[model samples]
Target chain A: MNSFKQKWLICRTVADVTYKEWSAYRTHSMVSIIVGPVYFMVQYFIWTAVYGDHPSLGGIELPQMIRYFGATALIGYLTMDFADWNLSMLVRTGKFLTFHLRPIHHRSFALFQKIGHRSLGFLFEFLPCLLIFIFIFGVDMRPASLPWTILSVLLAFLMNFYVNYTIGLTSFWLVQSGGLRSAFMLVSGIFSGALIPLDFFPHWLQMSQFFLPFQYLAYLPAMVFTGHYSLGGFELSIGQAVGIQAIAVLVTFGFNELVRRLAMKQFTAVGA
Target chain B: MKRYLDVYKQGMYSALQSAAAYRMNFIVSSLITLAGNILFPLVTLLIYRAGTSFPGWSLYEVLLIQSVFTMSNGLSSLIFGGVLWTTMSHVREGSFEVILLKPLNPLFFIVATTFSIDSAGLFLGGVSLFIFSAMHVGAIPVLYWLQFAGMFIAGTAVLAGLTLMMAAISFKWVGNSRISELADSVLHIGKYPLPIFPKAVQAAATMIIPVGMVGFLPASALLGRMHASDYAAILPCFLFLAAGIWIYRHMIRLYEGVGG
Candidate 1:
């Protein structure tokens, strides 16, 4: 119990420090206000143009499409982190050596830092964007089951961090991992249903998604928030989807642990 | 003009040397960029496969627009995209003084120094996609190709103008990297048919911001879809470039170094 308390305190302190550090760059975070709405506006125009008279396309009505995108933007604010970039840069620049002197693991520090950064993002990026989507964009921000949606979104946050962290560990092997990282980001963007609903994809691709963790990053939560859970041709209940998400998170976390151990052995700071 | 051309050639040589030093990274980066560029076309294919498309545009026609958009974007990024990051970093680090002290024009120096070889991926992908879609859409006359050449140059100019403006904003904003995201989101409207947008947005895209010229107008010219009013956008395109240059120069005067 004392160890748990100590760990909690460390996490809180790290998160607070991160929040304070990023608050100075609030303008950077606030850019989402303009970017999110503008992207939504583009979607608005495209969907409006496409759905001229049809009530729905690809099993989603016009209203639900707006909600899906709105949820995506908002959930993205809550969950997104640059952990991969941060870790990779530290490794590449030989800065990861500095963490060796500290008592805490770098992964723990990164996780705590993410908590703090995302805490700030929730306030600065998420809230204002949420209001914009609700009032200006008229997107129904209400969730199917608020508790379940929140739980699902939280799982997604961990899933995203673990996936990106795993990707970042690749820098231990590759001298220049930017290309690989970009490739992963591109694939993740598509497979995560951040680009379009996975339901719109061909059956083969949809079925393939069953084995990937990318869908848990954005699609499942967005679908749950929109009060429907259909992906890759399978309709799942909110409970079942979140349960799968939790399992994916555990599996990814295990994989990340294994990668981290292997990557640490390969670590050699050339300059430092 | 000859001096600037010489400087640009030297800059290209230096950039190519740097890329060669990291040959694997260069190749991988270019391929990733190619894959990233292919994403939108994949999205477009899915949209059309679902039996819905932009009204008045067939799948190949829309793909043509997207491919043109990619090419114009790729060319501009290769030429001017570096200006944004270079200006931002230089200004933030108080190295704008170094740029000012340079013998060549500051803007030219930044643009010349910052040539992006990675965008070759986008350019090549665009060319391939353009060829594939063009083959499907039937042959184009030499006259249309001539018109496309002119309009495509204008399209690239408009993007360069946008790049300069974003770079200029960095002088005041300081490390506002998301500014590019804002620009990209707004510019994304150009990737589609202008007619699909609201009347005001269409007008804004043509007259005020003139993003339409970046893709729609060029592709329309190629596809024989250009209306008479579309030519009006050409003047704004030049004006916008002038405005961007003016803004950049003006912002340079406003820059008070890192401390002040």
Candidate 2:
């Protein structure tokens, strides 16, 4: 085989190994699946209270809002990335040196491994849970623009992965990214609109979402899934969302590649 | 008790040295925590700005609950976090034997030895929020201030107790590491007004989980939103602490060490 095909095969094998590895942790994966519904349950009551005697709040009806949250839950599970954790750990423990000896790029290897891990998790946990939620909420679950939405979600995953990979590379210098990790965990839930709909945010902040990549992680996809964003809704524009997400993937990946090159120059393996 | 205090003082002194050696990491970690805690209140600020208020909850009232939860949870995690994680891991690895070899209570030693300075970022963020929201909450009687302090401490106690209990359960339940995450989800719910939840969830949050007292109930008492019965909410914290202690003791007896 040519070198390119050989590398691709190796990356594919990494994904397979990671999928089987993650599949062993049945109980851990099950927690979020269990927790997502309870979250929706709490959201159900909270929204009911917010919408009492009213048809909608902020232009979203109760059922639609609940469905948005349900979709957000599924999309969240699907797009979540922890490549930074793997990178940080490998750097901290000096295991990253081993990657230098391997022909495949570390970033490519980690990305493929995560793709495998998330695929198994999406299949075993998110798919069934989302279907059940669709039944419970009586949501249509049908996309207004299947092709565009699929493209948007694919870009969403790429953007999310590169963002994490960049953060993970920081460990090459920072040595301990645990604090950064916790901080990211806390901030992303809100910024990504997984905690609350970005539509409910103030106008300027919602506008800022057009500039920030975080919204592509959950908000944009969920909105696309809910068909809330038509070709153009209130001037924010679906075309703009797609444009920004595509640009974000390119810009973030460039940043990650630059960081990797710089960090690799100074990298010294200090431990076994 | 004095001996335990002395041990804790020594442990804290050592922790400070460790902090000094990794000063940059320590500072960055705290800043991260500070940033995280501050971002949630901003989310609340925007939600209310969108003209969608949680019925019966003014924006400031919700901020007050978020503030209280941050302070109580931060304080508990800062103080008991060492005990919480170490105890669970030690039990799992059968390293409880090493803890027993020390001439002190294993729980107290664990709690004392592990002082998380990083939580100070969260605690400070909470204080900032509490002070900022207090300006809008209006003047209150001195008694209400006292009531607020009492309830806050009690709420922290309940949080600490719940954490310890979950750690203890991890010993017996194997693969129950996620129980602590479950507890966290409960506290996450407490970020909003408890009254907004269904009666069943509210009841569970009050009696079974006692998470309501972790923040919402205490803030409500300060706001005078609680009923006569709600004043007794602090009563559950005592029971939770007692149960936690009892369970930890029972689990220690059952610790057979890590099996081959």
Candidate with top lDDT is 1
lDDT of 2 by residue, A23-67 (tens): 887567777766777777777777777777778766778877887
Instruction: State chain A's TM-score for model 2.
Output: 0.91
Candidate 2 off by > 4 Å: A1-8, A135-147, A230-240, A270-272, B172-179, B258-260
Interface RMSD to the true structure, each candidate: 1.0, 2.3
The digit string of per-residue lDDT tens for model 1 on B138-184 reads 88989889989988888888899999999999998898878899789
Taking the candidates in order, what DockQ does each have?
0.84, 0.50
Model 1 scores a TM of 0.97
**Top DockQ model:** 1
lDDT of 1 by residue, A27-102 (tens): 9999998888888889888888887788888899988988898888889999997888998899888899998668
Q: What docking tier does model 2 reach?
A: medium
Query: By summed lDDT, which 10 consecutive residues of candidate 2 chain B come out lowest?
Result: B173-182
Worst 10 residues of 1 chain A by lDDT: A174-183
**Which residue window of length 10 is worst by lDDT in model 2 chain A?**
A229-238
Residue B232 in candidate 1 has what lDDT? 83
